[model samples]
Target: MKHPAFFKQFLITICLTFFLAPNLEAQTKRIKRPKSSVGISSVDNYVRNSFDLYDKVYKYDGYAAAGTPLDDDDIDVLEDALDDLALISESAPDILSSLDGQNAFKKAKATLQINKANKALKYSVKTAKELLAGEREREKDDDDSSESNENSDEESDKNINNDNSNDDGEEEPSNVSDGLEVYSKYDFVPGDKILFFDDFSQDFVGDLPSKWNTNGSGAIVKLNKVEGNWFELKAGYRLYVIPDINELPEDYTIEFDVLTSGLSNQTSSGARLHIVLSDTNAFSNGKTHYAAVTLPLGQYAAFNINAYNHFNGKGGMINSGLTADIRDEVKNQPHIAISVTKKRYRLWVNEVKYVDIPRFIEELDVLNYLKFHLYGLKDGEERVFIKNIKVAEGGVDLRRKLLREGKISTNGILFDSGSANIQPQSLGIVRQISQVLMQDESIKLNIIGHTDSDGSDEANLKLSKDRAAAVKEALVNIYNISADRLTTDGKGETQPVGDNGTTDGKALNRRVEFVKTQR
Candidate 1:
């Protein structure tokens, strides 16, 4: 049965709120809420609407207060009520921002109303979320289908494909999970051959991405903080966004970067960013054979990140609700890495390996496509964006290649656009190679850099030389390799491995080569 657009948004909203709002009763009891504003009727309505629900919550006891689960019909009613609240959350800022105080009374009213709205939003959001979480425990227990049971908790992904934001890079950096040195054990590696790569640079802002298909709505956006373009993901129940990458070999890796906002302890949790591996490219979740890895975004620190998987049409279970708590790291823009090697599956958030399971992926060849499914998040309130998605064939063992062939050329080393500055994540490749130099004191290397044919030949030539010099610098300063042991060279775009006309081709053309020589 096809659901109206309204119902689809409810899918993840309730689930996220289920976890985000931990204590509703205490949350709703604001010590001293001020009076409503004089000129803003909408503000008054928001307060009244939230208060009505608040009254019922305290009156008959909340979903947990009275010690009983709400009926299925009641759950539907609450969902409908949440829809109205979401609209109020989006529109309230506009209404409140427009309020001007021409006089003392007017200014006082503005201040009072702002306080009222903030408290009401917090209380009401908590009430709805906690009720959803506390009430639906039984429902979750009874539910067997993979649909509702997905381990998802994200701030609404409603901004990826939308270009309507006033964000400049001035906002403080998101709370990044610290101590990356602990994640040195991150073992997943990308494939050597590029299959699909997109940074959204080819797409225009405020337009839907050209190479992606979605049953829901999203658009391309450029932000002041992050470099390049990103796709804003809209939220809906069971809504799937399928990328243009069509074929996936049995051994391949998927990597992407994610950014989020409007997540806090006061907000509700409602969606999971579902990275799915399917047998078919259709809109459905591939009923016959599929594997999905769930990512919970935008939750409070009290909750641990959960990894839930649906394998071979619900016939098996490897793990669910693992204690991989990345709530802090996730909100701070983490580089996500996933590798599928034959039948094994592994995932890492930033530098930490969070999940690894043998036999988790049942059929390696049947998983041919990749897609994303997300549930409810209020439009304009919560947001998630993604960029730099690379799907490549399984990588060769570079260490082995270096020892055997005396040289290794790789595209895994990345740099900032239009510059030779190496991205922090790209240091992993360098770190691995540095180990090889340490193990064999007699080995020395000539570092060579190459680029695609996008700029002037002179500029490209100089940029490649600078890049190779940068690699040599990293070997000396960061990895402690002797500077005398390395030589630097640049071929620029003269030596091309793939076509420059296409994304993958261009990605392959930009390479860094390490050639071993006598010390």
Candidate 2:
């Protein structure tokens, strides 16, 4: 017969052991290794190789570099590798959650980092090559100019001495380096087709295909389908149309098929396909910043974009000139390819490369508006058929090629309290954010403040708002970010990033986020 106190204590211990044992076991299970390996092959191997390449390249040069002579082939390879690595990295949380041993996954991630580094290295080499080529060309031109001057001086002296001046004595200087051209020739593996033409059978908001919106003509996109495909409005001409405004590398390739019926003489105006860079929505009225390609009914042209000082009226959209002639070619069957690198923009008709525009524009201001459809002038019934559209980024170096071009930063501060005041210890974090913002004037940000579910809804909302405002004030008053450029919002407890029950969950929930809003 055991004492009553001892028996009660034993019972309590049994109950706790029964309930808490599985939880501890579950935690251990979460970290366990998977039985089957996520094999390293094909793109995985490429990633590994990329990391090795980056290590070697960076060892030679302190900073990563960009690729030279941008072309389709190399762009494809680099983009494919980036896509793979991005997919893998994005899926990491899910994989870790399901697996018992997450150590292997970490190893895989290590491999991915290496691959990214290598891609950067490749780009750096490309950029170096371009610089070297440009330098050599300049040197050669200087030499030729010197020789021509010497000849002219000799001829002038002779004329003065003999009094026999002849116009025929002047000779046209030969362009010795005329044929010296560099072309990027690396080929990329074709990417998996993520988008289908059928998917756009209905109009919708940016990126989200399921969320439908009425078209510019107050008609739903689903009702405007022809031959099982929805009619897509030209990028610039349509009042409301889906725009492909995604961030892209400085050197990349864009290819698509355009099917169009010949334009009607009365209403046949060409549409503009714009590649803009800034933070604003290009489709909105009076958008100021963008770089674009205007494809007329029978012609193509390029433009350099800028914005007016004031936001009251439509900003500048200055047209450069017609790049090529396409009058002989009818619409609806032609495959068009536009390839851009750090040096030039090249256009291709069908498979034949035609227009090679030299690198006139260095950095387009509005990179966010990379893709758009320009509408033709005629309204009766001109349709452009698009198919097999592809985008790719190329080069060998990973860090320089993808990460640097992407401009992704991983430095920021996280707070545990939901109050608006900046804690004394968090001064360093505030300074870091301010410094980065100051350094990149072109950079814009979305500052979001969040809170855990500990206080009343109204109080939390105000607190979050106050916190975001506090951060914004600090940035503006202390750091000097223009009030107009910075957009601040407080979501309060409405957007809890993690669970509210656990301590770690609460920690993650009470946070502020700064997302780069501009290119």
TM-score of 2: 0.30
| Model 1 spans > 4 angstroms off | 1-186
Q: How would you encode candidate 1's per-residue C-alpha lDDT over 1-519 as one tens digit per residue?
A: 224454445545554544564643322222222221233445445555555554444432344433444555555665555666677677766665555533444434444545555555555565565554443222333223222322110111112212222233111212122222333344555678888898888888999888889987999998764567889888787678888877888888888988877766544554567788887888766867777777776464444445545565675565566566666555767788888888888888877777788887776677888988765566788888888899989754677778889998889877767567665556667777888898898899999999999999998998899889988887786778998899999999999999988877889999899999876
Candidate 2 all-Cα RMSD:
31.8
**Residue 241 in model 1: lDDT:** 82
- lDDT, residue 139, model 1: 34
User: Which candidate gets the maximum TM-score versus the true structure?
Assistant: 1
Superposed by TM-score, candidate 1 places the C-alpha of residue 449 at a distance from the truth, in angstroms, of 0.6
Quantify all predictions' global Cα lDDT against the true fold.
0.67, 0.42
lDDT of 1 at 333: 78
User: How much does candidate 1 score in TM-score?
Assistant: 0.64
Native-to-model Cα distance after best TM-score fit, residue 519 in candidate 2, in Å: 47
The TM-scores, one per candidate, come to 0.64, 0.30
For model 1, what is the error of residue 514's alpha carbon versus the real structure, in angstroms, after optimal superposition? 0.9
